[model samples]
Target: MFYDKVFFLGKILLHLSIIYFMIASNKIIYDRNNYSDKELISLYKKLVKPRLIEEKMLILLRQGKISKWFSGIGQEAIAVGVCNALSTDEYILPMHRNLGIFTSRNIPLHKLFAQWQGKKSGFTNGRDRSFHFGSQEFKIIGMISHLGPQLGVANGIALGNLLKNNNQVTTVFSGDGATSEGDFHEALNVAAVWNLPVLFCVENNGYGLSTPSSEQFKCKNIADKGVGYGMESYIIDGNNILEVHSKVLEIAQSVRVNPRPVLIEFKTFRMRGHEEASGNKYVPHNILELWALKDPIENYQNFLRKENILSEELEVLIKEEIVHEINEHLRIAFAEEEISSTTENEIAGVYKHIHFIEKKPNQNTTEARLVDAISNGLDKSLEVFDNLIVMGQDIAEYGGVFKVTEGFLKKYGKDRIRNTPICESSIIEAAYGLSINGFKSVVELQFSDFITSGFNPVINLLAKSFYRWNQPADIVLRMPCGAGVGAGPFHSQTNEAWFTKTPGLKVVYPAFPYDAKGLLATSIEDENPVLFFEHKALYRSIYQEIPEDYYTIPLGKAKLLNEGMDLTIIAYGLAVHWVLDEFKKHQFSADIIDLRTLQPLDVATIYKSVKKTGKVLIVQEDTLFGGIASDISALISENCFEYLDAPIKRIGSIETPIPFAKNLENLYLQNDMIIKEVNILLKY
Candidate 1:
């Protein structure tokens, strides 16, 4: 009986000791001397909401109610503090684990729950999952899976804000692992060089998946790299909610006045695994215990309670209210429709506004080279649209490698015509950011072969964003491609087929000056990403009398260059010029069709010509295998096979890399190959 009494006394003492420690351990690390009592309580509530919601999400995941959960349980302080510090008009691009950003922005709880479950009422309308969707109304942009690319996107938004002189700043987030990506460095360099108003945040959460920071990067701190990029940077304790809030709040306001990029590295930890399913086996037990002792929510609650701003009863009441609200939102989201009403699976028009619209001014004419015609198209577009921006390397002063933008810098100010560093991927990302906003951007690649470096943003982001979120990307990529200029393989490539297969992109390859000017105008007016290919050889070699006024040609329409009944010759770019020259030289009785737009191929024209002639010959400047010629030939065979007298024939460059020698370059993708192929098709 005495031993049992001693044990009960010991238990009582242990409980009392924990209570005493909770009160005594609430140290004033970051004094909240400036904020009022009401404000302090409100900040504590903000810190509590996301932790509770994330815990509930994990519970749902365990019960198999939700497919996945990315826990931000421990890192709540940074998200809440940073979001509360920014102004409502400033834009934010958040990573996957930034639930507090959505909640602090006052996004409707029900809509966010629906988005996680992919319901019809979500921001993306059941298109994406979790925090993968953004709300423009809230001034938030969602990050794609590649976290580093969003930095460049933030650059674009900040650039737009600077040009408008709205005194607004932009903020973007990423983790320590993402700092190792090339886009991270490129974005900082671009932002610093342009002096854009942006705040870049990095949360060093000890580990990226299973890999620790030591293995990922050799730098002492992620913020240290900003010095090399010529930007101001800082390091802060992310666990201190008040400190995070006060520092960011001050920097955000000051950045609006100074208008430059700043990098802030928040030293924090992910108390949970990368995702709930991944488990925290990689982290040590002692380390976890150490971090748990520094929990942001618990510490903030302790601080508030010690300062007499929050009572125990009030804290419990706040949690109860938040839990009830979340439960109600979850209940409503569970009952909401998970798909669109118009279709069983939501595949809306992947790309809209594709039909060609022709615009012609008075018949005033002037002889101009293809390059001059392109310049005229851009000059006219810039004159008409005040929000248009042109960005590329050597474009501002040097006028581009092809001199296409020669006088643009002098005419338009530096903001309208800007030169970028040798960064294709990040600039493309910036262009995408501008495109989604109320601006149309034109990005030029010095050589078409360089498209490979920027392929991800085009294919994964720009090409699919419209279908995924109904956000149109109003941008144009000018590609200088083709052989016979002796630029070697790295510079010359007929790569239209690379983008022709993409759904949301439009491919425009014009053969002459008149077509180049008109087609460029049509492309500029379209609200989708357009891949405008210009053959380097045809830039100066081809001259024609084009209308000196602003005119646009039909996008998906084919031009019937010549008419006959013997054979149908279909071509584009340099191949069209080849067929035209061949017909003039040999006087062959053939129907010549110039496919001005390669994507929405003029099926009616091609079919009619093939049916009348009973023979067809397709040509391209790309290699013989897997070119647009193959798709055109297959389509002709499938639909117009019965009308054809012989199997369809094609002429293209041999399946070999473009050579540098003048003799070899002249023979490569030569026009002489078309005559031989046409003769065989006519005889058969």
Candidate 2:
């Protein structure tokens, strides 16, 4: 009985010890009197510099020396506080108004001013302005004009850190207004699903552009939404730099090891309008006066005075030094020459020369259908590269709409082979994030026609990413396209021409099973972004012997199926088959050129054929207007005008959507249409 009493007492003591330790570890590390004086002074300087720089930039804007400025006049505390929490090597994806983050990172003041002036000394070398550029060396991601997409991108970066086993947490900033964008929820959901090491900081300045938070969200605090995604959420006084710093730092210390996302909503206000051009007319005067009373810099200065670390003379001296520093930087930035129109800096200058992959002899061959070949190609690529990942709707287990990814989930697991929500724009934006972090993503768009839903990321972000920042986005978008199976207009459309005209994109379309397998291999291995189109009709219909050993077909090179001198037929995708069928029946002595890749068109082969034949006929599956056929016809008229004996002729689907009726669908871009166009070229 005495031993039992001793054991009970020992157990009670152990429980008490654990509770004491827990309380000690989480004890508040700083208070009004206990905070370090040196650190407080440093934070004060960080808070002051951004305020002065913003005021100077406004002055320059009035002088017509800078184009525009987005002032973070009232929100300096959040920027400095969050940046102070991060380690030097940790990544930061910040918004334009977060100037304190830049100053804290030692981003030179001259370069910042030069960027605003559109000068050569800027980060983008006059290619962009106003926080649209990021430094790979500094671990910062350049911001796109669209704000919310960065949240999804931050998920990718944090996932990368997790994969690398690097115990580093990433912080991304967004305004309260951006939380309304779909990308915000999409990113938070993904990060929470994966349990990533990231902190999403929302500067809830009560207004987004001109809209107030009352209209922006139905909830009271943006932090309230974090719990829905299973993340820890908090609301803090943003005007108090000490409070913001303490909370972020404490959370950062925990998340780097435990590795789950946290959302901290900094309750602040935007002192200035959206830009200098927007002069605070939309904001209420009384609201501005209320926030001015809580100014972050003024509050910090008052705190410093209470601590006896700041004096009136000292404050004046510090301001004078910063003013002189700003003037010197501005003078140097202005003296820097503007970027000239050189070959390297011109439009389309971002595209590097195509390094074509070499062809190899086919060996260990196996006969396969077009779909099987494409599936095999993707399988081999995933097996070969650890960095390669694939994502799409119903791709994880359903194996995709056409079963192209049938067994990927079981083989690769859900991490690499992912199933995403029906948010098409976020899918591509996530891919861009993955690509920038040294991972290659092969994103599948279930149907080519659905690209309209994801067009903004393709045109605005993906197509322009390389040109703006010269970063390699190694992504391949697989689009199953074309008509002939009577799936109707929406599902059966051919949209290759839409991307072919878009710069910074490589478009590839193959006809046979062998070409499909080989070209997919090439696209996966290539460094640049490629839009790969596979015709649905050819998936099961076309069959051929494909090499078991991997080999890549060179991009921007054409295959001459048959050579002749009477006429030259130019075609690609499914149209190539129609031309081949018509030629065999008519017994025409024409050179048939199959353009396997469309972007960097194989002009040499086409020109050589046209020069010998002296007549041309272009065929396409897309509509007659704004299609590749029109571009090729114009090229022939300009380059081979003398070689051509007759005016260049082309044929395509009548400018109308494909109909659901069998007879009407058959009348569109069928073999008979090519035969009719071929007879005209033969007669000429």
**Model 2 per-residue lDDT tens digits across residues 423-539:** 777788778877777898999999999988878778767777777767767889999999998999899999988888888888999998888888998888886789999999999
Q: What is the C-alpha RMSD of each candidate to the true structure, in Å?
A: 4.4, 11.4
Model 1: lDDT of residue 481: 90
Error of 2 at 279 (Å): 1.0
Clashing pairs in 2: none
lDDT of 1 by residue, 1-684 (tens): 999999999998997676557535634385896999988888888899988998898888899878888888778999999999999878999888889999999888988888888787887766667777667889898977877789998999899998889998899999988988988988999999999999999999999888999998898998889889889999978988999999999999999999999999998889898988899999987567667877888888888878888998999999999999999999899988657456524434577645665776788999999999998999999997899999999998999999999989999989999999999999998998887567889999999899898888898778877776777888999998988788898988989988988888889999999999988888888888999999999999999999999999878899999999899999999888878888888999998999999977899999999999999999888988888989989998899888989888888887788988888877776668888877888788
Residue 31 of model 1, lDDT score:
82
Q: Name the lDDT value of residue 23 in candidate 2.
A: 42
At residue 382, candidate 2 shows an lDDT of: 91
- Among the numbered candidates, top lDDT falls to 1
